[model samples]
Target chain A: MSNGASGAEAHSRTTAVALSDVNITFRLADSGSYTAVEGASLEVADGEFVAIVGPTGCGKSTLLNVTAGLFPPSQGRVDIFGANLAGLNRQSGYLFQSEALFPWKTALENVAIGLETAGTPQSEARARAQDWLTRVGLGHFGPRYPHMLSGGQRKRVGLAQVLIRDPKILLMDEPFGPLDAQTRQIMGNLLLDLWSADRKAVMFVTHDLEEAIALSDRVVIMSAGPAARIIGDWRVPLTRPRDTAEVKLDPEFHRLHRDIWQTLKAEVMKGYEQTGGG
Target chain B: MTRGRLLSLQFLIAVITLLAWHLATTVPIGGVTLLPPFFFSNPVDVAARIFKWFAEGTIWKHLWVTLIEAMLAFVIGSVAGVLIGFWFAQQPRVAAVFDPYVKAINALPRVVLAPIFTLWFGLGIWSKVALGVTLVFFIVFFNVYQGVKEVSPTVLANARMLGMNDRQLMRHVYWPSALSWMFSSLHTSVGFAVVGAVVGEYLGSAAGLGYIIQQAEGVFDVAGVFAGMFVLAAFVIAIDWLVTLTENRLLVWRPVAAETRTQA
Candidate 1:
């Protein structure tokens, strides 16, 4: 088991998040149990972008939730930075897949929500929100409501909401799942550029192999449920501040992609077999 | 401009109808009054009577009394309904337990409550206001309760994940979700508010348009009764218009229908 000091030093050197033997289960009304994730252990090094890829419903989101401290695991522990996550209020930043921007608030206000929640003065939060919005290339759209913005723009606002906090760890749950392929690629590159600058450890959850490979320093492939676990973890040797388009042309990228695909293919098939497929 | 045109169309229809009634009463086909003498009581006579009432009774006095009663009921009922509805919505167990009781109360003939209210509060404006409040409360309560209950789980989860405390969640998510429903019910409640006030006045009251109408009916004055009804209808329409204006201002985010857009 990775101890506290090792995790801290690792973060100082580029480790952002650490989880040990984390397990999550849901109890049923019929007195039965379903283990969503079982004994999943992993470390996200500081400045290291990691992706957790799995077949649908493999508890990738459950793992993310545990990491965020939104849900306590039925077993094991999760530590962010060098600190135990027992009573920490705002250790990590999260970007939900749906963008979940408040419909009543403008894009700027939505971005400022995190700072406001953390007790930052309204003016300071608004200013920081504006700065982050500009960074996301949405400066002009600050006043537009969520309903008025397109899917891509809403995701940008969601990203800005988290980025404004500048937490030690970033957890994103399929942030670009709803966007078109082109927009998804654009967002992927943008995320890489943003992360490359500060290099906060990011645990990005996605089903897309291409997305995982493009943005992550390490790809953690999770197995299928009734008990989804991290079956393989591969360190991608792709250079930092990488261009997604350029990375695709590298033969090494293709090799890693093929390996990850081969490992995930069986899990995907098993998932299909378990739940009658598409 | 469209509003002006619509008003003009209504005036044109009123004039034509009045003219037809006048001609039918005067023509006297086959020595029989084709239209009853009371039915064709010339628009001129009704207009003169309205003018007399306007001058003698002072339209503002009666208008003020009715307006005060309706407004009082509207405020009392709406506030109580929202408070009770929100409280009930927050506790699912309690809401479920009391749901049938609320429905039964709502289903009971609210008009029947007017006489009981009159008995309790007397023939004063308070009785009318109380009756009006009873009628309005249930409509607003049910809508607000349903609205709060129907808050999206996805939105609630998102708010929770964003670290919103319970009060903040209620303000940001639940309140806004239920606001539109509450406003829609308000539009309907306004008429009921007026109806309750009028009914209470009719059952027993010394003042108000309802009392005037009741008095007219006692004297076999059909024209006066119709005149009183016309005044009440105008009052109801005016209140409805105000409610609509408030709704439009509050619900600015709601998309305008294609027809309204084209009309604009």
Candidate 2:
């Protein structure tokens, strides 16, 4: 027992997240079973931002879900902060691909919910939530419910909602997938600015290649499914404080984009063939 | 439509209906009554009956009884329904076991149970309240169950990820989701509550507006019957208006039809 404890402590010092030989199979009572991810091993170091990019049906989100400890992999195990995760991860925050803010709560209340659930006094939670709303450029919109805000504004509230929790690891699944190009660019830059100040282990999942390259220290690509696995990994050597839009104009960015696309394009075509161009 | 236009149209419809009723009942055709006053009382006589009831203040006793019965039924039934609904939603195995029995009970004609309720609780306020509860319970129960069943998966996941325990999740998520559904059917459930009370009274009772109307029918006092009906209609409308106000205040986060029009 003491040996296990020492091993876990040592693992915690070096790794923020570790998934060893994870396999996820979804059961369909009528059609048998479908494997989403198979024999996938990965790790995120403390304070490292790793982006997983793949084809449309490549099971990227499934990988992120495993990291979040929402559900255990059908085979193998997940470790969070070096402890074997048996249930919901207590040390991570997730930003969903779609709107996940409580529609019944106003922006301030939504932001404060994490604290409120953790036993913070209502008044103190509200005060801190208000501060986060201001940080996200929604100071005046605190009293407005999610429905009253435009899409971009609601996304800002969602960001504040997760960020206010100060989770040791952040799992984002296409957090800006629904926005228009202009808003997406703005949100990307804002995220980078916020993240740079207090670096945490981040595992971002998206199909957007430019987004993955612009925002990550390492970009990992997964193969198309029937049992998808990590197919490629690239080190994003872009300098610090790089702008998402401006960085695209860089010659190095173009070269990396081309190299990554060479691998990604084939997987995308295979996925399309499997789905009959859905 | 504009509020002013809508109000004028409503007033016009009411005025035309009343004018037609008065003419049909009072006007003579070929020196003979078009419709006998005994069967269809004149508008003036109905109005007079209403005024007389108000002046005597006797109407208050019956009105108060009915109101109390309906309010009690609404509160008790809503609480039970919401609690049971949550339990069943949380325990699907229990729900599956009892599903057929519940359906059978719900499908049974509620009015037929009035005599049974009277036998169980005696022919007084409790019997009427029991009937009202049966009517109120099903609507609220089904709505609460449906609300919980249809709670957004993403929201549920988000709540769990926020480190909310079971009790916290219930208070913050399930309760609010159920409430929105309850308020959506507020008017209908409350309306059923009143119907259950009045019907139970009309079938067998010594007091209440329903009893008054039943009494008027026995003597062929058409004006008194019409007066009782008008009073009942007004009472329901007033109560429903109050329900609407409460719903508006509680569900301020929800978008209303009027707000939607302006938004677009």
Candidate 3:
């Protein structure tokens, strides 16, 4: 109840993102209601980096989408920046797991969209987008289309695209999920570097425990679904300026990994048995 | 294929086809025409008739009339289709309500409406334009509807999260998506627009390439009919070439398939 109740109480103080008793259910015509998340609550403090790790199909993304205001909870509440979120969450930016970029836009145009939407003149937006692309190491790729870039490069563009808006909260759903292992590490380090410069409330959803531990201030785990809820929360005590590849070697990292895995393994096994190893 | 080799192959094909056509029409078999020269004019006769039409500049007026009708139909139909498609796509309830009626209208043979259009707009260019509009509208409308429906939900969510208001979302997300689909269907719709115009003219018209062909057939002038067809084809090919050029320029963002053939 502390996990479910903390978000609502935290609202009395300043909190970046607070989801209180959020429940999401999909109405199927033939079948009855399919509950994805029930009584799930979480809170992210200002400038904190939090990662939610869980078994596959554990409704981790549904929680993030609720915070983004893309899907309203059937019951419960979502408060962002100390205010109730009505429709779209303007204070947050989302990086999707799939190819969310507009394939028709060049890298620069894609990055510049938020500024333009905010009524910045086209030229200023373009210049600022180019600067952000440079920061993401894609300055020269400004004119290139999404299809022309490699998967890693596109993720870099997606990073630049979301980060350019300067959203107070960043909701990333497995942003580097499509990358190779080596690229994922590089991106994780890059994300850490950018985040260290100016911290924001980041809710990163990933199933990779090592990635979650390497890049987060706190790690939250949700149970396997049919109405998934938060099962565990742990503070990551890893040092700053961390390299995702190098951080795994620490004994403390291994200890945290083992402890979290102990809780996570049971859910993973249950999920497998229920789906018949699907 | 190398450009030179491809061009040579194309030239060879045209020459062989023309030779076959010439021999079939002119050469008699068993003292009987294999294909009557009066009905199937020899390539040489058709070519001569085409050269004569160009020399006298008599085909220009008919070509102009047909071009105007097709262009008008293409412009008007595409604009209306896009506007309606966007409106219907954004309003799912309205779209569902009108879905069956739209399908019914689209399923109706547009050629059947040509006579009715002629009755309404007379035998002028408007009747032909109306017919062509009908042909172009449904292709664009259906493609646009599908484009809007098939829009990547992830991308839409991303756009919304990026703080795009309704107008910006439509302009940045929906418009570009629908435009891509519409552009992909342009080749088909453009061809159909010409078909509509010519068919309308053929059914009954005082002017246009179709009218010339119809008049030539009435007087048993096979060469004239073939000449008119050749001119019509050349005109359509030119328009198609322009459409392709515009498509390349606008859709530069689209991914091209890797060149499967080994590099030279």
Model 2, range B1-264, lDDT digits (tens) per residue? 988899999999999999988887888878887778889998899999999999999999999999999999999889989998888989999999999988999998899999998899887898999999999999999999988888898899999999899998898888899989988999999999999899989888878988899999999999999999999999999999889778777887887822644543
Tell me how much of the true interface, by contacts, candidate 2 captures.
Answer: 0.69
Which pairs clash in the backbone of model 1? A11-A15, A14-A45, A14-A46, A15-A45, A15-A46, A16-A46
Single out the weakest 10-residue window by summed lDDT for candidate 3 chain A. A1-10
* lDDT by candidate, in order shown: 0.82, 0.89, 0.89
RMSD of candidates 1 onward, in order = 4.1, 4.7, 3.5
State iRMS for model 2.
0.8
Q: Considering chain A alone, report the TM-score of candidate 2 relative to the true chain A.
A: 0.94
- Candidate 1's error at B99, in angstroms? 2.9
Ranking by TM-score: 2, 3, 1
lDDT of 1 by residue, B1-264 (tens): 589899999999988998887777666888887877675566666677788888787666767778889999989999999999898998889888998998888788877877888889988899999988988898888888888888766566666656678788888788987777888677789988899888888888988888878988888787787778888998999999888777766665444422233454
Off by over 4 Å in 1: A1-15, A29-32, A82-84, A87-89, B1-52, B55-57, B256-264
Docking class of 2: medium
Indicate whether candidate 1 or candidate 2 has the larger DockQ: 2
DockQ metric for all predictions: 0.35, 0.65, 0.79
